[model samples]
Target: MSTPTSTDLVVGARPDHLISPHGVLDLRGSAGRDVWLSYPFDAAVVVCGLPGSGKSTLLRAWAASATVVDPRVTRTSFEARMPAWLPYASYRPWARLRHMHWLRGELRRGGPLLIHDCGSRSWMRGWLARTARRAGRPLHMVVLDVGAPEALSGQQARRRLASRRVFALHRRGLARFLRQVERGGQAQVPGISSVVVFDRGQRDRITAVRFGSRPS
Candidate 1:
């Protein structure tokens, strides 16, 4: 099979209005008792989770209801700064900082409206929230938590089957990714109001998480 294009990797788009196969579940209502909906149209939503936690799948589903933001139309740059040998390691602190800078600049210019596919580490999330607050914008996060063991196994399996050298690098990256998630779990980040946990079942099916006011 040919390499997937950026468009192909882009599972879903941010719509003018929110849409999901599960119907329009009001995010504000689910966020928390204290959570408030600022501007429905201009909020920055970050969907984060471990590898194979269905973050992409969920995003794709959500994209159906949203007016997908075209990357070409925005002045945004999607930088996967993870090292070839360990993409997730290189991605964690440094790449996140770089993205933060880019995000800030974009926000000043009315934002490029980014959707990061990487895991949302505590530091990264904190930095992003700070940046958004500074810009007078609300940062909405959708945390998709899939346990580390399953995610790592999925990564390893995928890497083993991939036909490219890049896949080998991704395998190393997965190792680093597992480390990051483990660390992030220990150091929980604040300011996150929404969390979605997905447990993987047979055939890549996800057992939906029972989200409550606080992280479970």
Candidate 2:
């Protein structure tokens, strides 16, 4: 796959800025927060964000663009259409393990795979990093830092109203995940070598970091 052109890196220049027919767009970058972007055809990417922070939007956009870039590449949203075992609060721990196993298996057979979820969870990300290393595939992260206040409001007003139970669960999970990411600041997750901050004005803020390096 070719590198993302200067136009591709710029916001609104591409035909689909937020949600293209081929991909999804993340609007939370309008706020002065970080937005991470992976390589053009990374084998695996974990998109992290709170509810309404536009995780789905970013994943879809990436997926769409990937499809156009390389039809051979398959882009799937594992979190969006989660299996039944993942929803029940009681079985999340076990379900998470199972999901990781499944993801690893998929990567072993993959060309390009993207995992779109609230990957702010340190434990989950650690597991994914290990799995990526074992698979010898490069792992990248796209951290969407839409402040907690906006995320909470978006969840309550839009997400919660749509599905109160799911939204409530997501709310709690998001809070925990954000705290973990903030405390660790990307150092906790191995192989996450780059970060992009999507702030209030600048839509795309890409920064490169070495593996195990902390963001300044």
Choose the strongest candidate by TM-score: 2
Cα lDDT for residue 20, candidate 1: 18
What is candidate 2's lDDT per residue for 168-190, written digit by digit as tens?
66666656754544455455445
Candidate 1 lDDT over 144-204, as tens digits, reads 4445565556567655332345444544553454444335531333443222222343213
Off by over 4 Å in 1: 1-39, 60-97, 109-114, 117-120, 157-193, 196-216
Question: TM-score for every candidate vs. truth?
Answer: 0.43, 0.55
lDDT for predicted candidate 1 compared with the true structure = 0.40
- Write down the TM-score for model 2: 0.55
Superposition-based RMSD of candidate 1 using all C-alpha atoms, in angstroms: 13.6
- lDDT of every predicted structure (CA atoms): 0.40, 0.49
